[model samples]
Target: MKNKILLVLIAIAAPVFFSGCATDAHYVQTGDKQQIISAGKINSQDFATAANDASRNLLSMDPNPLDKVDRSPAFVVFSKIVNNTDQSVDQDLLTQKIGIALTQSGKAQIKIVDKLGEDYGNIDDFLNDKKTTRRPDFTLSGKIIQTVDRAGRTRRGTYSFQMSLNDPKNRAQVWMFEKEIVKQGTRDAVGF
Candidate 1:
């Protein structure tokens, strides 16, 4: 009955071998410890952290510029945010978080001054048969810069998020903030 014992052992070992080779996937929260980290690129967690820090710093300004406006919710338009990083990045990842925070704070309203905004404004004006005029009191602009350093087999990357709130009318910077995120690991390491 050697063949019978062999079949039994094969059947028992097959499941164990297959299970060991399979990987189970699961959901993970953003910025979780299990998130993947890259030394040469900016990760989503980096964006979130930088945005949160920048938003907090902006909101914590003494004599908050947002409160100085005459309107209940000051109008703010987003200007161009220059990206000096080697990798292509979605700026909305940074601006949207800051926008949501400011909107929820009840201190500012984001106004889209682009062609799309104008098109919607025109459609509303045509439908309502009245022209409404408004101007942004402040402009939000910034830049993202990346710097990298390597020591033997280990690598490090730093991303700097610089932002400024400026009054368009008087040409003055009301508030400015910078947030830097650094990631370090060995060349083959994937997660931090």
Candidate 2:
């Protein structure tokens, strides 16, 4: 009877062992249709989502949607974005992607405020010097915050990306956007 029970246990365990060992190499689309999603880390899809949301929000709230294209794209200056997450994250992972999308869509152009000043001289010096001054029409700034909660063996995390486009001339926030990404799984879960 003991031998029969042992054989039954082995039979049930065999498939699990085999399945765990089997891995077929395959191709996956970047930032989409992946079985494994990592938590506690930023990924390409997150950037894409953030950029898409910002672009869509900008277009939706555009005061003059009809002349959006006709009007010269506004010059965007990068402002300080706070990182409130525990993990070290590259801010460019979020800003640069949004900038590129905005540039490519012909809606806006990114002006490096620091670089521009550095190239000319300095902010104070530029103001004192008699040079052609090009002011940035809009400024992009925001923050990213991460929150983690776990239930038993499963861990869930939410990352919030907030961005705004402010009209420096009028001191008004012309456009605002936010995206929250939630990922759930544990470290031992090979495929999230």
Candidate 3:
């Protein structure tokens, strides 16, 4: 009778004990204070910060290349973004953010183009040669580079986000910007 009662008590208390130990899921805004940080890899917060900085600097240019275009909103194409980091990262995370900011600001329009500056339109349109694509005034390209340093158990990572705006007509670089983000933590310290 004692063993049976003990077993029943354990079964009831086990769930309550385990439930207290488990963490409940919650939603938080991007780049929140509670977001996880890693020393060896780029975080979402890092991408947001870099993209924000790039957009601000690009929009603040004195000459304002976007204004020099014949059209109200300049058409811009993304050429390529090279990733030199150790880990695989989607370049769209950075470009898409910048693109959204620029588009929302009404300064530039993003155009999808191939290497030859052909529009990536519908297959039927291409087959019929119904090319309504306008030549892009500017092309945007970038590269992400990562460097790491270690001292004992402490590890530090620095990521460089470099971008350039080029005048396709003149084939000259109109604007260039670089943002560096560094993160440091102990090897065993993984989460927030």
Candidate 4:
């Protein structure tokens, strides 16, 4: 009797489990409907969305001012990026992506603020070469904030990505950008 019951249970459960997973598989974009979201940690799409926003703003900048000054684009030194989130995040994943996009667009250049290092060799060479080396007209930096709230069976999360471009020479912040991503669900397992 015990064996028959166990066998019957397994037979019923197996088909349901397999049938639940029978949807056709297909490729999906990073942030598309097929993407997975986890409540415990940051997701790749979150980073990608943030990167895309940053890239758009950085590239949209006018490179004309720097172009007229000679050849080198605006040289920027990375500033202190305050990670104001509860989770430990590798901030470079965000900054480096933006830096690459900015460099490729020819609108700005990225530099290390630290003055002492063998790494300075490249920047020094540019400064010495009249063909290159333009002082950074702007400094880029920002912070990320995550907030969570729970009501009944629903949970809500909001992640805010903020960035600012400051004119170091003038000691003024020129541009400020902020983007917030929010997700809500009846259970944490299904939300981001």
* Model 3 spans > 4 angstroms off: 1-22, 113-132, 188-192
| Candidate 3: clashing pairs of residues | none
Best-fitting candidate, scored by TM-score: 3
Q: Mind giving the per-residue lDDT tens digits that candidate 4 earns over 41-137?
A: 5677887889889778656656533343344677766665667778888777777878888788876778744332224343334344433344555
User: Looking at candidate 2, what is the lDDT of residue 141?
Assistant: 82
> Considering only N, C-alpha and C atoms within 3 Å, which residue pairs clash in candidate 2?
none
Instruction: Name the runs in model 4 displaced over 4 angstroms.
Output: 1-13, 16-32, 61-71, 112-135, 188-192
Which lDDT tens digits does candidate 2 get at residues 1-192? 999999999999999999998888988775555545677666667767877787667666647331343347866776657789887777777778777777887777776543434544544443454447555666678888899898997888898999877665555777777899888877623444
In terms of lDDT, model 4 sits at 0.68
Taken over the whole model, the C-alpha lDDT of each candidate is 0.81, 0.70, 0.83, 0.68
Tell me each candidate's RMSD, in Å, in order: 6.9, 4.5, 7.1, 6.3
In model 2, state the lDDT of residue 32.
50
Better of 1 and 4 by lDDT: 1
Model 3 RMSD in angstroms: 7.1
Which portions of model 1 miss their true places by more than 4 Å? Answer: 1-22, 112-133, 188-191
Tens-digit per-residue lDDT, 90-130, candidate 3: 87888899999889999999964433334545334433445
Clashing residue pairs for model 1: none
Q: What is the lDDT of residue 58 in candidate 3?
A: 92
